[model samples]
Target: MSRQLAVMMVLLAASGLAQAVTKCQNGSETLYTSASCPAGYRNVTGSMRSHVMTVPGVAKNQEADRAMSALRMQAAAQNQADEEMDLRAQNAFWNQCLVIDYRVRATERAMQTTEYWSYADRYREHADALRALQYGMGCLG
Candidate 1:
């Protein structure tokens, strides 16, 4: 049993010495034999290339990613500005309509028995004016 174990260990050492370990610089994937390594990859050991050699197609993908990120940020900023403008316009219109409604109601009360039809017409005209303002501001569009 001792002689057989010694023979097995020797065979293992011999086989290990016969193979060359190669590691790709691109992704650090190791290979048992140098011949099994892919064509575009170089060995980590002493070779004719620089250590910081970038893998093919990596730079182009990075550039595209950067451009896409910039475009997304620009689009988000534009959307936020548009939303703020709409909110400001809505608040202004609401305040104006409230004031107009209060004034018209007070006028109706003051002329309770006189010029009722004219007061109603005045309220309709104020409402039409508000609609026109909304349309011009692109709120209705």
Candidate 2:
């Protein structure tokens, strides 16, 4: 029984030694052997152990990055839409100003050509009111 136990112990130690490996790197090339690395090769066994370690938060961080990117894109699109609406409103306002200016000029011409005093006074009042509106809107500039 002692002889058998001794044999088993020797076999286990030999197996453990056989399982030990040395990892070596030369530039981009890598080698794994049960012996020591050759000259000109760097031992990378410690680095190999570090590479197997699990780093926490890597997946969660990637998900958060994607969420932030999506939010930024949504904000940019909304801003563009708001700008387009503002531009359309400005165009409509300018069109209204142009029509009002034309009416004011026509009223002044009528006041100059009319012979009836009351008609001329009415035209004058209408023109003044249109000019006041234009000034209030900053359209006169």
Candidate 3:
């Protein structure tokens, strides 16, 4: 996992004033966090740094899980319909590096049932799942 993601796991465990002091400064991404948990404030150290992706945000605690699951399910369905129609993924594009249709000549060595998707598909799917999880946890209604 990326250092940012790992730090997120730790930050998530912390809350209230404690979390407030645990800032992940990117010198770019602007985000605010709520001070509600009881862990108390303290500066976290040894967070990983990167040259490209600057992540910034705070994770909030939600009391309900079932409600979130319902909302996420509904959202996923809608998103899937939109995605299928668009034939697209967000983290990366659906590259046409190879022809999606047609097969080799009759003398071809062999053939597969369906063309393999670009490797980025897995990453995009993971991102979508994570998004659903975070959205579910952060929502109230």
RMSD for all candidates, in order, please: 13.3, 15.6, 27.9
Give the alpha carbon lDDT tens digit for every residue of 1-141 in model 3.
Answer: 445854764565453322332333334542323332233433223353332222233343233456688899999999989988676543223232111111112112122222445544554455455445445544213
As for lDDT, the candidate ahead, 1 or 3, is: 1
Clashes of 3: 5
Higher-lDDT candidate of 1 and 2: 2
Model 3 RMSD, rounded to 1 decimal? 27.9
lDDT, candidate 1, residue 66?
Answer: 100
Model 1 stretches astray by more than 4 angstroms = 1-56, 112-141
lDDT of 2 at 130: 97
Candidate 2: regions farther than 4 A off: 1-54
Ranking by lDDT: 2, 1, 3
lDDT of 2: 0.77
Q: Of 2 and 3, which scores higher on lDDT?
A: 2
